[model samples]
Target: MVGRADDAVWRPYEDGGSLGWMGTQGGTIARDEDFGGLARLTYELDDSRSFHALSCSVTGWLLYHRFFDNAAAASAAFEEMKPALEALLTQLPEGGPSVPGNARLGGPILAAFTVRYG
Candidate 1:
């Protein structure tokens, strides 16, 4: 199930556990877990070197994760994708913010920490 987010590329795991990067986030890697068979994982391209994960419910509009990177590279990536981001924002619902304002964009660093801490 390969898909594109602007210029980045992603795909689902062989077991259908998680959707991950194909060649965009450095290389091929899959993040797997029991997604209750109802998870929708979306990768938003932040730049040429980075991206964010927007994990949501397949049956509802509930957003589970909004991972972001705060590195200089990520900042530059965000700037590069600002216009697209704005366009995305315009497509949001009218009532309120669809995503949390301070969700952490899990990346390599955060993944390492998660493995080590939990």
Candidate 2:
């Protein structure tokens, strides 16, 4: 259910290491799918195509941002996916949030994922 397209960028957590983990590996943009409601170009740690994303608060904050190996695709993908991803957030469950071990949603959610070469 998870793979890559022909286009993906390869940017790391470099150019300006933030904290201890800044220089560490960023992550693979398995898909341009959306899982969480991160506004700053973020995605779930796993299962971008599903609501079964598992991550603690800390990990969730580090959601991956998908990029493209090509500039044209990059802009297009970002533009197209941003609104779609943001809209998903508005459809979250009415309750507070999922428990310790549960899918983010009670049903399946259609999401798009983007990724880089890394």
Number of the top-ranking candidate, with TM-score as the measure = 2
lDDT tens readout by residue for model 2, 1-118: 1122234222222332322221112433322322232333322222232221111111121244343444455545555655544454444343324443224452343223222212
Prediction 2 TM-score vs. true: 0.37
lDDT, candidates in the order shown: 0.35, 0.32
Per-candidate Cα RMSD to the true structure, in Å, reads 15.4, 12.9
Q: Give the TM-score of candidate 1.
A: 0.25
Q: Provide backbone clash counts, one per model.
A: 4, 12
TM-scores of the models, in the given order? 0.25, 0.37
lDDT of 2 at 82: 52
Q: Which residues of candidate 1, in runs, are more than 4 Å off?
A: 1-29, 32-34, 40-48, 61-65, 70-118
lDDT of 1 at 99: 39
Query: Which segments of candidate 2 are over 4 A away from where they belong?
Result: 1-38, 42-67, 94-97, 100-107, 110-118
